[model samples]
Target: MLKFAKYFFIVFLITAILPLVLMFAWNNSQMEKFHNAMAKSAMSTGLMRLEYSVKTNLKVQEGDILRKLYYILPNDKNLSHIKNILNDYNTEVIQKPIKTPVSFYERKNFDLYCVTLVPFDNSTKGLKISKPVSLDLLRPTGPYTIELRFNKDDAAYEFKNVAFDPMAFGPPKKIFLLLSRVAKPHYKENSRREIALKGEDNSNAAYLTIELAFGPFRGMIDSIFTSLIILLVGILSSFVIGLIIKRVFVTPVMALSKAADQVKKGNLNFKLDASSKIEIIKNLYENFNDMILNLQTKEKLRESFISNLTHDLRTPLVSQSQSLEFISQKFKEIGLTNEYELAESLAKNNEHLLKMVNLILDSYSFDPEKLKLSIEKADLYEIIEDCKEQLKPLLAEKNIEFVNNIYKGGTLIEADLFQIKRVFINLLSNAIDNTSGENKYIKAAARFEDEEVLITIEDNGNGIAKEDLKFIFDRYYSGKSLERKLGSGFGLSVCQKLIDMHNGQITVESEINKYTKFIITLPLSQHPGKGTKEQP
Candidate 1:
């Protein structure tokens, strides 16, 4: 989740937030440049007013030079009468030629306050020094400031008693006085400007200096707040996007991963929760569902092929067993009973083989169309007798006694003779496989009851577990594991299908290591309420 959140945040930054920052920077820079141009015009006007105050108003001329400083109020008009203002006794202190011509000072008064300077030329000089200007113009009681210097060499001025000054407040870390030669100096805000002092006249009056300031600091402050808002929004959006990503992308993908694991474990029937609001995941889910269905179809086809192939293999074995039976009888007629025994053993084994083959085929033969039963009237007891005879070798091998108690009267059943015989043989063989110990016996009896034939095959053998009896009729479900390898786990399954086709029901009852009984109820056609035309 954290990984997804991280990636989502990055994507949001690139796709959504980056443009906001770029646009803000570009606009802030452009506005600052435009403000500088406007400030220059305003400063040009201030310079004109100062030049008029010096040249036409004060009107002192030729070689009038002095070097002394004094603070004067703007209302003081005595500046027009003061003589040799620059060439006074202070001028004799260090007589030298004055190269720089223009000068100015910070203007702070009862009704007005402004920025003192921005960027100025080297040829300009500082000839005027004004009182300290308060920067907290929005506050009634504000910090005081003053510029204290008179040099034209560097055109740089130093200030005293800034509001944040440590001497007056707390600690002093550092202060900023100048900016380098990039574009603007010191600052570029609506609250600050650059002042330039220049004129054509010299010594006529106070130096004609121009004072201006850059734009205010509010624009920069607004930009900073905008950036902070964008940062906050970007962070908030990152978390929301992270959750969306987990739902739309991560969740479904993990489900698919678990589905893959199920498939690997051969669970083709494991269903996927493919529902989704995302278009891409919906498509993927549909494709995966199709894939699982295809695999099931393929598996069914493979099972059907093997089952049918087993049926084909059983036909030749049946014929070979009949041939061996005929040969065994001929040998017995010649009093060669020892030679006849081998032929009889092979014939019975062939019968067992046919029963197993049929069981294998029936396991997969769920469709009634695949059965192809040729319904005809046949003696049920006679078929049971024949199936018993076919399994005589296995019975003898286990020393088990087989009792056939099916009635010889009204023993007619409208059933597929071949399939009926297969079922009878399968039941007898299964009993023989399970029968063990001395005096092991299996009994088959049939009786007419309520227009149906009740045929039961009971055995005193290694009986089935009660839990296993219920699943005995399921395809490939064995009553006991002992008979599993020999019987293919499909004897009772095949019997149940054959009985169902005859419109009859088959059931079993058992107790472990005691007795097992299988009851088959087949509808009799020739009996009172039953008829061949109606069904089995």
Candidate 2:
């Protein structure tokens, strides 16, 4: 479980951390775009307000200049005084070297008359023009004698442009100021657009001008602040998500895994809590608990069945054995030869049957903790010969060869004589049941090796399949082929248990259609250790 959790946590971290980092980066990018868009929107609104402010100030300035020009025009005073004042105002206030020029014109028959009070060259202030400038060059359109038109040639004129005469014609009609730019050469290309006045008619018109200035855009959000916000959100989200997964997925799965291990180790009472909110996890826990409960139920039924079965069979088998021996002795005393032999065979068969019943009882009631051993030096060959004698009828019926290959004096093993004899009987009986055909043989062999007695019971017969080999000795594990007529599936399990109690090991080697061999290794002396007790 420790190893599994370690590796699973690594996988979880990879799955969780990588996506969180990617989401953080993507969210940061989106937030930056939104911040820039809001900043631009705010700047656009500010630009509109700035344009309005410039228009209002330009209107007031225009009113003052118009008043000065009007006084000079009607009073017929020398325009030089007002023109000089304009030049001074332009140089000091407007920050330009020349004054705003004004042209005067009056309608005449089919043509127009125009004169400039201040020349474009600015050579002399209020220089009276010798000739009229062309009125058509201004392209005056609509009811306002001075019309505002955008100049494409002057790219810096982001606002509208109005070309008009700055000097007063007469004081009579409606007038308004317009913010606009003048065409190039007269001012720098980057200069702010000029503001000029519009009049309803030529009878009483006065025009004045000023420059409009606007500020640049300034973004509001800080880069570091945006990054901090993203980081905080990412961390909070990761924490919440990680907590949820641990509660919903990881914790429940680990619980189930631990529970499964306990069940495997014969702890049928172990269970897991089944009350999870997640549907799949809840179902999983519920199923695991249900399975453990079923196993516990089955185990109880099995133990009860074994107890009842052994008690029912053992009593009758013991009585029948005693009765059969008495009958055999009576038949011998009456001098009925054939009947006496039949009775003797019946007695032997009855004894074998009684032994089988006892074997079943012992196998069912086996417990490692309650094991008792009568360890003594006994002949292993004598035990094998006895087991063969018990199974001699079955061997003769099948015309099989029974080969005892033990050394002359017989190998001795420090073990319980009865348990060792039972092991040989179970093994030799299994070999006899499986072996057939004319040349079939069951071989019993033993040797002393490495301070242990190695006993082998082999058969030339249909060998065990590879799939069944691993589970061959497990209780109630019946292989596909070795179905004994006597026991259910406890023979090998019993043999293995008996060998384990003697501080010994039993193993099997086999190949399909070749040969099956059972190898039993027992220490020359029963060592007082695990699975062994002092023969008190």
Candidate 3:
């Protein structure tokens, strides 16, 4: 399920976020292209307008020169050369100039530029101009109009016929380079066009060429900022969507998984707390709760049935055991040889049966309330001796040696005497069952360790395998051995439970074909709050 959630998150992010990212990239590219094209167009339009204005100013200047020559001194021989130049101007005058010679003429809105002007042959004298005119005084109408201020030292200079050197203007404005970059191939220096002005005779035409400087538009979109914002929004949206998905789907499934684990570990009382908004998950949680409840009911019924059945079978088996013992005694008294042997054999079999029945009742009919301990100071050495004496018949049958290494006086411990004795009996019985070959021996030892008594039961006969040690005390987990298989597999589980009631620990260690040892540690005295009904 965790893998499924991860897979789902990856697939969802791809589907929800991939297309948006692609679209943003493509749109940003297209927008950049469009903005560049628009900037180029704007630059071209600026250049065209500059060129048209320069041409119009040049025509006006030519008309003013011609009017001064044709009407002001039409027949003056000294200015006849000027008339001849006016006749060769090769352009119609668009502006109406005064018939009389104007003292000073200033056309501040003119945009045409030239390094030198040749109005006529060398015989004609040039017109006088004022000192130091600003270069920007020529073109005053445009999106970007530059006014070049004259320095104090430059104001001493003068020009002829309003003509000035282009060098004195210095380098062009910084904006021209930016404009050129944006326009590129469309607005280069070579693209500048010269206008031809012709007279009525259409001969000896004068030419006007002007350098055009385009203006820049610094209004391009900020694609980086926009892309960042798009990316941020995309991430935030994906996170919100992913969170919703996990909350609505993944969380409930994880809860169900945890609850299922608890149930697998034999905890039927665990209930899932699923409050899902999704309908299907809600139904699933409800069904899971119902299943657990049903199992609990059936488990209780099965336990009750086992309890009643064990009780019913225990009564008859106990009675049969007593009757068989009496019949064996009576047959022995008559000394009916073969019949007496049969009775003894029957008595042995009946005794074994009775033990099996009692084991079932003790193991299966477990009620925690009825299994409370009778906590008191008990003699540990006495318990070990009693277990040994009770299993003496089996020890004699197998010819196995029993070694008790406890201090003879007695070792005292706070525990339930009956449960502690049962623990020892179970450990010894297990040791005896596994120790069957020649030179078989069982050893019991105890010692004081801090505030606890450490007791061990060891057997020298074919020891338990290394792999079976961990599960030796688990319910119904008898090891793989011929003698181990002969009895019901609940003895060690019962021993472990009884030890836990005394707040003690039981552990086992073994090596294949060497020896098996069961170690038990019990507190010398129970804790202050521990009582007969203490819960472990």
Candidate closest to the true structure, highest lDDT: 3
> Ten-residue segment with the worst summed lDDT in candidate 3?
107-116
Q: TM-score of the candidate numbered 3?
A: 0.51
Q: What is the per-residue lDDT of model 3 for residues 1-536, given as tens digits with 9 covering 90 to 100?
A: 78888899889878978877777667665665665575455445545664565455555655556455654443453544544555533322223323332222222233212211323223243332112223343332333332221232222222212223331232335554543343342323332333343322343123333333332222222343455468779878998988987888788888899899777645688987646668899899989999999999998897788778878887887788788788878888988878878888887887777777677778876544466676777677787888889999999989999999998766888887777887788777767777887888998899998988899899886777666677677666767754233256677777877777777899988776788888999999886444474334
Better of 1 and 3 by TM-score: 3
Per-residue alpha-carbon lDDT of model 1 for 1-536, expressed as tens digits? 44655776687777766776676557557655665665555445544444343333212212122222223312222433222443331111112233433332322232221111111122132222122222232111212222222333333344333345321333222221111122233233322222232222321111112333222323433454565467668757765876787778777877887787777545688877667768899889889989999999997898878877987898898889889989999999999988999998898788868866765666666454455666677888788878888778678878998888877755888887777787777777777777788988999988889888899999988777656766676655544555232255556666776777778898888776788888989888633222223234
Candidate 3 regions off by >4 Å? 1-266, 276-285, 465-472, 476-483, 528-536
Ranking by TM-score: 3, 2, 1
Error of 3 at 491 (Å): 2.8
Candidate 2's C-alpha runs over 4 A off are 1-298, 317-357, 408-412, 447-453, 481-487
Off by over 4 Å in 1: 1-292, 304-367, 479-486, 526-536
- Arrange candidates by lDDT, descending: 3, 2, 1
Q: What C-alpha lDDT do the candidate models reach, one value each?
A: 0.58, 0.61, 0.62
